[model samples]
Target: MVSRRVRDIEYAIRDIAVIADQVKKKGKKVYHLNIGDPLKYDFKTPKFISEALASASHSGKNFYADSLGVYELREEISKFLKHKDNLDITSDNIVVTMGVTEAIYFLLAAMIEKGEELLIPGPTYPLYINNTKFYDGVPIEYELNEQDDWEPNLDDLRNKITDKTQAILICSPNNPTGVLFNEKKVKKIIDLAGEYNLPVLSDEIYDQITYERNYVSPASLSKDVPVIGMNGFSKAHLMTGWRLGYIYYHDPENKLLDLKEGIAKLARARLSASSIAQYAAIEIFKTKSNHTVEMVRKLRERRDYSYKRLRQIEGINCVNASGAFYLFPKLDLSGLKKWKNDKEFAIDLLKKTGVCSVYGSGFGKYGEDHIRLTFLPELSILEEVYNHIEDFVR
Candidate 1:
């Protein structure tokens, strides 16, 4: 029998990838808009960062780094956050993990006790919910305001609070939805955290991938609340395979000392992250500016074109994402009595039109009638995928 801890865990994003693999085995070409791996779509990591990795690997700098991270990477990360978000923290406050995925696991395990609650946004990244369940913690999802371009509903959020709630989890320029949490909602979230004396675990993994709105870290805006900031080089730097991510503790009232200690203890048990990747990260922070700007520009163009095309389709409702590389379109399946849910819609579309996507239910119940597709592909490929999806839906 499988352990209960391992049951009920599902990643719909990659689950469809498994189907795509099977389809490819039959010599069929599948157009993937499913996963967010940029490298799979011709977005190469910049040469300078790769050169740093090469140098480190050859120079015998490949030994185990500090448990949290190498000094150079940590120091660069501190300076990088200071420059990017104006969020002040030293290297000591940071703990490096395999990726934001691991950082999320560590944070959930450290903060949530058995049967305790961690508040998360509905239609979130999904990893938060899975990790909470794995750690024997309950996840309480407050809805993101889909009616208002997927903004945060503070009243709904406040009503969801309970004595069991430990921390509030957030994702800005969010996944699945492809929208930022609004400023007013951001202020209210921080205020509630302060009032409840709870920690705010903010995932800023896509902080630099904005199109219209300026990116601001939730940790930068909080006054005295403990902001457990999670970020990484995966999205912004095209270092998905590098598997380097970090978490920082902003325990202004010295309230998070024990939690920080617990995180570091876990870090020590795991030992160091990839030493070569750490060295590469040092250079990545140094060389991130131009590459990021160009990438964002390209992504914005793709976002605009894809949104326009999706909007033109009948029975499709989209929020027109302002940031990130996803287009989450709500399909009007009222007339299609054959399809029962988002997953059925997505799977049938794949079998018929060879366009791959993840269903909205995979994210959470909030996205039940929707499906998320990435615009990370080249403009031509995106145009083709959109055409195929539109024709199939019609």
Candidate 2:
């Protein structure tokens, strides 16, 4: 028998991979645009980082790490925030986990009681919604206006906050939509959270991947509000398989000590993240490399090409993503009487054309009629993928 929480959890990003695998068994090639992993395409993890991991492992650094994290790595993260974001965070306030996924799980477990709510963006990364459900917590979605570059509808956000709301979650250069939130909106969110005396869970996983300059962290802008900033080497450093991420607590007043303790307790329970990866990451943060700059340049080229081609399609409309590698395009299924929803359209497209994509509704309620696809593939491959999608639509 399955538990209700397990039954209700739907991670459409990976769920569609099963179908693609089955389709591959029939000798059809599947263009995997469904997931956001960059390494699956043209990207490669830096040689130095890999070497660091090998050196650590070879030297017998194979034992379990400190549950909080390696002191040297956490110290690097602290200096990273100081230099990059100008946020005065110390190593004691940071806890490393098995990626931001575990950081989120630990946060939910520590903070959410049954029926409490987490204010999150609609059309969000699915993990927030699924994890909240697993904790028996409510995910109150605030609208991001597609007509206005997917910025948070501040009025809608303000209206959604209630007494039961636990924390506000935001992902910049957001997944699925890939639109970066502007500075004015970021400040507004911090202001709102301050007014409510609530913590802001800021997911900055894609902070370094932006096309534009001057990306600000919510923690940097806040003076009194508690901002739990989450980031990792996965996206910025091309270390997705490393399973290393950390959350830094920013409470200038030193008010949220209990919450920090809760996270620490959970970290101790799990022992620690990958020790070899943590050792590698310490070197990653210490060294300055042009790898992300080159990665962004290539990704931008792919993004531009994919966005232009998707816009040319007759029945699709997409907001140009400024950061990250995803493009969430609204599909015009009205004329296509055969497909009832995005899921049906995606499945049929995959079966017919061997192009795999995650349907929009998998993200949240507001994501219906849309299909989220990544622009992480090479231009030549993307050209073929778009051609198949256009033909399928026609």
Off by over 4 Å in 1: none
What is candidate 2's TM-score against the reference?
Answer: 0.98
Tens digit per residue, CA lDDT, model 2, 130-198: 999899999999999899988999999999999999999989989889999998898999999999999
- TM-score, cand. 1 vs. native: 0.98
Give TM per candidate: 0.98, 0.98
- Among all candidates shown, the one with the greatest lDDT: 2
The global C-alpha lDDT for each of the candidates, from Candidate 1 onward, is 0.88, 0.92
Q: Listing every candidate in turn, what is its Cα RMSD in Å to the true structure after a full C-alpha superposition? A: 1.2, 1.0
lDDT of 1 by residue, 1-394 (tens): 9998888898999989898888878887799999888888878899998999999999999788899888878888888888877878999999888999889988988888999998999887889889999988998888987789998778888898899999998898889899977877887899998999889999988888988788878888887999999989899889999898999887777899889899899999988889999887888766635888888988888899999999999888899887778889998889666699889999988888789999999998888999999999999998888889778877
Candidate 1 backbone collisions, by pair: none
